[model samples]
Target: MKRILIILFIFLLSACNDNAAVEELKEDYPEIKEVAEQFPESVQEKLAAPTVLPFEPKNVSLTYAGDMPGNPKRDILHTEFIYGDGVGVNLHVTTYHNKNTTWSSDEKTMKTVKLKDGTEALIEGDAINVKQIRWKKDGTYYSIMLIKAPKVEKEYTIDDVVRTANSMEY
Candidate 1:
């Protein structure tokens, strides 16, 4: 119940795409708002805008996850690439132009790591739990979230997340 309430609170906060927030985001991420104006004719076209992982785990496939048009919490071009099952890896790719590179993720819960390409990344949570790999590359942000389920046999690691993040091609 506590977890549900927390999640609901976050959802409410994120869904508060009120005029003020939208205006603030327009100022904060103007490029994203510009892109939003030119949002592709179709969601399929928008899905084609993001860089994809060059190397994917066996049996894992990419899917077109939808977007929230006119979202005000952040003005971003969002494309999601789900690498395995919903119980496996959920990669969220967000493109926006902002000087603020920091994410809402709690720094206390994340450990910083340096990627092979010399880029800095944050590993959220713990390795044995639902971990996420977050990094900013070439002005774009990539978040690789690992979802472990009871029936899922595959066990993912931080290395796997980093490798997948590294394999992304813009």
Candidate 2:
């Protein structure tokens, strides 16, 4: 009976530890209210808060990385998801602020795709490689970018990235 009790105690402790780890992972996702201030002016003008989250992989967690502040090339916001123990996927969302000139110049090298919603999307690189998809809606220029991730454990495919973009509600 004493041996059984010792084993039960060990099992309970291990289970509790796993739960704590999961909880810690969940806490990584920042509260929108708290991270709102990190958004660039153009993004703030367009979105009340950056709350669009795509379909994340099971056991993978997503966390807000805040706006890429002070970047001269673009006004961007970022979210990072991690899974497979250490692999990460960074999602970058950018806005051009209703500028036709900028949009035209930037998308010069990108292939154009028509989304189901009739939105014209400009894509750089295929789903298998690093990619950036740009589109405009209601005068707000937006982009969904997947940076090169470490090829360890599990890697995301192009279809995954496209699905992530389509999952965007706002």
Candidate 3:
């Protein structure tokens, strides 16, 4: 009986993990992987609270499936995400940050652009600073930019923004 139970437990664990991985893929694109590949992992750790991660192409595909906006050009870190909550958003970020504009609502303003693909089923949500953390209450997705200037000021999501808002940092 013990052997049978253990086998079932392992199988169940594996199954659950697989589902979660798939769900995460569908929810948050492994955009972090792309950024991590180029930059040091410590960057993610050093990230300050209320940081608005640069929207990467990987984030867009994972968050929402569709081709990225504009041509696949360099310099501009443009991308878009698809949400299951009947919402879609595109992001256009720059690698260089103006020193004078280092930190201000000016850099954290919002803009409304049309999804070139125009095939996703989602509602456009508000911008979390320059970042768009929409809830794919319906897709799967994740990231910060590899070349960053610390302009991340928002993370719009259907869920609580500061989930750890109440939890301790222990």
- Give Cα distance to truth, residue 111, candidate 2, Å: 1.7
Better of 2 and 3 by TM-score: 2
lDDT of each residue in 1-170, candidate 2, tens digit only: 99999999999987654434323334554443244445554544444112223334334433343335455654444443333222455555554443442455666666777766878887765655366676777766566666655563345555555655565544
What's the candidate order when arranged by decreasing TM-score?
2, 1, 3
Query: Lowest summed lDDT over 10 consecutive residues: which window, candidate 2?
Result: 48-57
**Residue pair clashes in candidate 2:** 127-158
lDDT of 1 by residue, 1-170 (tens): 99999999998886563334223333555653554444444322232222334234333323322344554443334544444443454544433333454688476676878877898888875456466777777655667766565465666677766666665543
Give each model's whole-structure lDDT. Answer: 0.52, 0.52, 0.29
- Steric clash pairs (candidate 1): none
| TM-score, every prediction | 0.49, 0.51, 0.23
User: What's the alpha carbon RMSD for model 1?
Assistant: 17.4
lDDT-wise, the better of 2 and 3 is 2
> In terms of TM-score, how similar is model 3 to the real structure?
0.23
**Top-TM-score candidate index:** 2
Ranking by lDDT: 1, 2, 3
